[model samples]
Target: METNGTELRISGVLGRLEAVLERENSLIGTDARFDITASNAQKSRCLYELNLLMKSMEPSDLPRAAGDRLIRLRSVVETNATRVKAHMEAVRDVTDLINEAVQAAEADGTYSMDTFRPAAQ
Candidate 1:
């Protein structure tokens, strides 16, 4: 089988993408210093390269191994996406709870009996 530039490029992109997905997955809930901005940038670049490569190649022409790798990479990306989404939801729920507590505290004030006393009936 003859290897073409497009096939090679696609494989390279997939490799990089897989690494990024693995890193992102590992970072989830691991430490306080894990930042996703750089990983996200790399992921975006890999996806852009992959999209361009896919557009240039016919799906039927891709090597079987390359196709399999693509499927695996896709699965990893999807799983990591779900993990990130779940983490975001947890953070949002905590934030909402904190905000509610703050609002309640602000509304409650120092709780003086005079403030609650009804006007002379």
Candidate 2:
């Protein structure tokens, strides 16, 4: 099969996106702090370019290798999504714990049972 310019461009975009997602997956649950904004931006740009390229062609026109690469990319994306979800959940749990601690510390206990109790004899 003769590889055309469009096929090459699509393959390049797919590779870029896969690399970004793999990097993101690696950093997601790590102890070191990692910002995902750059990764997210790169992924978005690649997807946008891929979308434009794909819109010009039909599904049947896609090369077999490109299709297989897309499938592999899909798996990487799914794994990245799962790791991101777990990371977000962990952040939320920490936020909730901090909020609870703040609320507890701020309480004056004015409504406590001891406040309404009779004076000692």
Candidate 3:
């Protein structure tokens, strides 16, 4: 079967996105810090390229196998997206808990009225 330039580019971008997501998943699991700014930038570029490729492509022009492959890749992307969202929520929850703890400690400090002396009325 013959493949067009657009299809090739789309496949390449999809592959790159898959690789990025895998790396992100590994980092998230290990509680490791990664340069998300750079990763997001790369993902954005790949998505932009994919959008351009799709815009120039016709649905009927896609081979059956390529279409199936795209469906599978879409599933992977969706799953990774869900994982990322869950991770963000977890991070937010932890941050909120830390802030609450700090506030509680500050409110219970040794300088409270219970520890202070009062003058006779």
Candidate 4:
């Protein structure tokens, strides 16, 4: 069941963890992070882990990428998460305000800017 265009990437830790599931795929960072396995199986397992994680993750309240030009974009993940959440919330608020304003306009049978200014400060 393929969804939209693929834009998901799971953490490296999870990738190595998946590799460890098989005796042959994990790398040898001298830790459980190294496993050796066939290329195809490794790829498939990685895709699966990424899917599992992405589906489970919830975006954060604020949106940003922590490291834009660092050696490794290690912190961008959380920032991306936060940004996703903030974008969703912001869109929701806009939609709700528009709906409310539309309802008000309908009820009054007039679309005058003076009356539909939304009670500005």
Candidate 5:
């Protein structure tokens, strides 16, 4: 079957999105520092373009290769989601620890005797 221009465009968008997600996934658990903002921006841009392209076509018009690519993209996206969730949870844990430490440090214990004192009759 001959590939149409729309099919080619869909394939291109899918490939770009897949690449971005794969790259983001690779950097998720790495020790080395990277710009997550840029990665996310790229991924969002790709998704936006893909959404526009998909809205112009019907599901029945999708090429076989495009369908396969979508399946693969779905798997990559799911994995990326899991990794991102874990990363966010780790950040939250660190933030909680830091906040606890700051609060502890800021406590002057000026009212320490209040807890020990009994109510006056």
Candidate 6:
């Protein structure tokens, strides 16, 4: 099979980008960064792939298949972000409660880690 020069160039560009990203390794798992670098990288890759896919498609082909896929991908990303935010919020709330309890116990001048421990069975 033969391909146009422009298509080959586009494919080459995407291939090189993917290779570079793969070599960089994950920045998410156990990094001590103040920011969530891994999540940001994943989000960036998703957006970049979507852009490349849309840009590569013919104008006439964009109405049905690609449009639907883009919609679904965006919806999934949004849902995941919401769920993660909700979970983090819940954890923060629990932590605040624990800190408050500890402070209250400390105010009485008898607070200790033992006070927060579960009772023996």
Say which candidate scores most in lDDT.
2
User: Model 4 reaches what TM-score against the true structure?
Assistant: 0.33
Model 4 misplacement above 4 A:
1-74, 111-121
**How many pairs in model 2 have backbone atoms within 3 A of each other, for residues 3 or more apart or on separate chains, i.e. clashes?**
0
Ranking by lDDT: 2, 5, 1, 3, 6, 4
Candidate 1 Cα outliers beyond 4 Å, as residue runs: 110-121
Candidate 6: residue pairs that collide: none
Which 10-residue window of candidate 5 scores lowest in summed lDDT?
105-114
Which lDDT tens digits does candidate 6 get at residues 1-121?
1235444544544454444343333322234452445555755775586476557667554444334544554555555566556656876999999999989978876877677889999
lDDT of 4 by residue, 1-121 (tens): 1222222233353445334333332222224443323533665676576566557445431112211212143343344345445655876999999999899977885866566576857
lDDT of each: 0.83, 0.87, 0.75, 0.46, 0.84, 0.55
TM-score per model over all chains = 0.79, 0.82, 0.74, 0.33, 0.82, 0.43
Model 3 local distance difference test score: 0.75
Worst 10 residues of 3 by lDDT: 1-10
Summarize candidate 3's per-residue lDDT along 1-121 as a digit string, tens digits: 2376666766788788778877776675465668666877888887888787777567897766668777887777787788788878988999999999888877987546656667657
Q: Name the better of 1 and 2 by TM-score.
A: 2
Give the per-residue Cα lDDT of candidate 6 at 32.
Answer: 40
Q: Mind giving the per-residue lDDT tens digits that candidate 1 earns over 1-121?
A: 3467766887888899999889889887686687877878999999998887777567787877789997777789789989889878988999999999888876777555667889997
- What lDDT, from 0 to 1, does candidate 4 have? 0.46
Cα lDDT tens digits, model 2, 2-100, are: 358878998999999999999999887794567877778998999999999888788999988889999988889999999988988998999999998
lDDT per residue as tens, model 5, 1-121: 3358878888888888888889889988795586778889998898898898778777887898999888878889899999999998998999999998777755766546666699999
Better of 4 and 5 by lDDT: 5
Pick the winner on lDDT between candidates 1 and 3. Answer: 1
Lowest lDDT 10-mer window, candidate 4?
61-70
Per-residue error for 83 in candidate 5, Å, reads 0.1
lDDT at 42, model 6:
53
